[model samples]
Target: MRNVSINQLDDTPRKVVALGTDYSHGHLLPFHTHRRAQLLYGATGVMQVRTSDGNWVVPPQRAVWIPPGVAHEVLMLGVSTRSLYIEPGAVDLGQRCQVISVSPLMRHLLMEAVAAPLMYDRVGRDGALFDLLLHELTRSEVLPLHIPMPAEGKLLSLCQTFLNKPNAHQSPQYWAEQIHISLRTFNRLFRQQTGLSFRQWRQQACVVLALARLAEGEAVTRIALDFGYESPAAFSTMFRRVLGQAPSVWLEAAK
Candidate 1:
């Protein structure tokens, strides 16, 4: 396979590469990881990034950060898109493991930043813009599209289903029994496979459910109860922790 040339750098230290492509239809990027952090965005249409921790759906305003060495893959959605791939080490703005929004200004700057010649020196306008872009990117909001997984493939699938049915009161051990495994076995398999405790995996499920419910126009209070939260305030507290904003505020902003 040909490595897509991102960018080229020369002189006075490390280099950064930015590569992009306009692709259409059902494009699938196989599972892989790299030394450079990847900031993937869609100028148009929707995209999804699948990492071991979860599946993050990319809205038009959002982008996914695949930190260095995280094995993952891409699934394209909607129409063709201009996928801007920033080279690693060029910018340390994006954090690991989150799907942040691409601000209007940041998006515009990145459109230009990616095109900046690799060999451009640090003193150039491109370098200055690149650095600024990094700062804005870090300040951007992370869209809610991540779905954490359990280690067992079945467990992971069940997690997705749980998100779709957050109101289900049945315990995972109940599921284990259905899957013909003891409760202990089910929990052990999930921990080994998903690299997270069962409780952590469930937390991810709750977040996904919250996002989906929000996307579907469900009220937070109802969603909280539906997700088995003790109260709306508790649910809102959890949401703020995971998404860095309260539900009422974020939902209004979403509008």
Candidate 2:
């Protein structure tokens, strides 16, 4: 159903419900939960999804799979979304949130699904399309766009602060000192809490944030300098390392 709230159709006796909506730049969907699992696809622009455990950045033409009842908030930038709310028993993509690569066939399926009848025929073409969609979702590539948040109070606070103004050059010792822990202990604790080493986590954070800025049309050179990179080339190196493509190439593909 185009532009309709899921609450109004949550009880529909169907395995999947497709909805499409468009959001202006900088739109925010506050923390909310859904009775059914959600495959939120961004046909245009980017999406930043935040849950209790972490944050995920969904670039244009990708999607984020949100498990049933997982409370989360979404910040949409110039996004037009096609959402599939599926019954929990209908498919099991994963237990955790995932940013997945959307293939061209799957993209067309989503577009068609969103335009199908709200109570589409279970024994007809609409049903066949949705069935293929579920299969495609199972085969979709999971992207490394998630930054797991720490649960420890002090460390979590420090991590949150860093996200506000991320810098590639921020030393691990700085974070350690801010939390009044020895550098060694901090390293161990950081990995234990977030399942990522300090260096890896910092780079992931920078790339995710840089993506949001890039979507807003910020120059790569400025973003690189803001993140303390010596040059745009240096920043692009890190970006390519993490995402497997230079910023310009990725952005062009996204367009």
Candidate 3:
């Protein structure tokens, strides 16, 4: 099923349909919906997934779980993907979209699953492989790679603007003034709407955004300064805090 579109085999009558596809750098998959839940794995490069509710960044060797009927758009940055389109009732990863860390065994299973037939045997080796893959999926760790969007009118607009040009130094007071609210009210509202404090949300957004640039080969120093960090060391500190590894180490592992 390499390089095949899921639309052509969505009704295969199987519990899961696997497809492997390669995308050129900067390729965009316009907004689309699937009848089955999707486990979209990026074997290389990075992926940016966006829906009405939020944006998720999937780095190399990781995957994003998309529930059925969720309209989403994907920006593929040099990604080679292994996708599992599962019957909604067959697995329950979750309702919301999330980036998950793919274990080595799960990665191997994905590679083999994509190579199996579209209608693989139900009681054969391929079937067993697919079964284990689903089990591994349930055990996969959920990463903190989601940037939820706010729904309030003023707050949404402000957040959108900030995403376009994220500045780490942007203070909560600045957003409060822009929305004509006091700092206290703004902080409370931001947490209520996005489920994250202003500082936490800002840092997460910057880290997620920086991941794409870093994957595209942008120098860390430049990205750090551009994002308003005082130094590359300072930027790496924050990146490690959120992601559990330094940028260079993370990049190496991703490679």
Candidate 4:
């Protein structure tokens, strides 16, 4: 659908509108906002979503909740998506965007919702399906797949660079000096802007990026060495520390 048509549907009285779309690897949607909140589910591949507030990664069978009017952009990594444009006030999702798990039932509901009439009978099967969809959304589990970016331009740039070549071994002093700030001030500002300490942020970034590489069939040992870990065991330990599961188990769940 065209951007203008999408904007027109923002406040429909129907309460919910489901749209299905697909993109090839590396497709990018530039920064944009919608009048309605969105649940963007990736049925086949991963998505990297970025807003000024932070960055989030959504892998296959996962989704992201974007509150109404929040400007964001999405990059598709071989994705097929089912997106729900929910009228404002239809659900009670908080303001920030978050990555959420998609249950098997939720997956089927989304496929059904998109195939039904756009203005299905209020008391009919389509309406019932959407009601169930909303209920399931309320109970969906939030995933630790977000990497919050700092607001400051220089620091945010530094963080972005680190994401391209994430190294968990990088010291606080190294990062602080790269940004030309004292270690104490850097630590304070980093937490102030991103709500995470430097070390915590780095680990989260690595984990999210690691998910993409793992999906692409990269060996765990290569990923470990590329990301500066001493060994695959070390990488597994760090991944478990942040995600509560070993890499293999986590990838299986994501698959």
TM-scores of all predicted structures = 0.62, 0.97, 0.98, 0.93
**Candidate 2: what lDDT?**
0.93
Tell me how far the alpha carbon of residue 24 in candidate 4 is from the true structure, in angstroms, after superposition.
1.5
In order, the Cα lDDT scores of the candidates are 0.65, 0.93, 0.93, 0.88
For candidate 2, the TM-score is 0.97
Tens digit of lDDT per residue, candidate 3, span 49-68? 99988899898999999999
lDDT of 3 at 181: 93
Instruction: Provide the clashing-pair count of each candidate structure.
Output: 4, 0, 0, 0
**Tens digit of per-residue lDDT, candidate 2, span 1-255:** 789989887998889989999999899999999989999999999899999899999989999999999999999999999999999989998788999999999999999999999889988999999999999999999988999999769999988988998888899999999989999999999999999999999999999889888977999999999999999999999999999999999888877
**Where does candidate 1 clash, by residue pair?**
6-18, 7-17, 151-193, 151-194
Worst 10 residues of 3 by lDDT: 246-255
Better lDDT candidate (1, 3): 3
Q: Which prediction has more favorable TM-score, 3 or 4?
A: 3
Candidate 1 or 2, higher lDDT?
2
Cα RMSD (angstroms) for every candidate in the order listed: 6.0, 1.0, 1.0, 2.1
Model 3 TM-score (2 dp): 0.98
Judged by whole-model lDDT over C-alpha atoms, candidate 4 comes out at 0.88
Model 3 global lDDT (CA atoms, 0 to 1): 0.93
The lowest-lDDT stretch of 10 consecutive residues in candidate 4 is 1-10
Better of 2 and 4 by TM-score: 2
**Tens-digit per-residue lDDT, 10-101, candidate 4:** 55579988888878899999999988899999888889999998888887889999999999999999988888998889897799999998
Error of 2 at 175 (Å): 1.2
- Model 1 spans > 4 angstroms off: 1-4, 7-15, 79-96, 160-176, 179-255
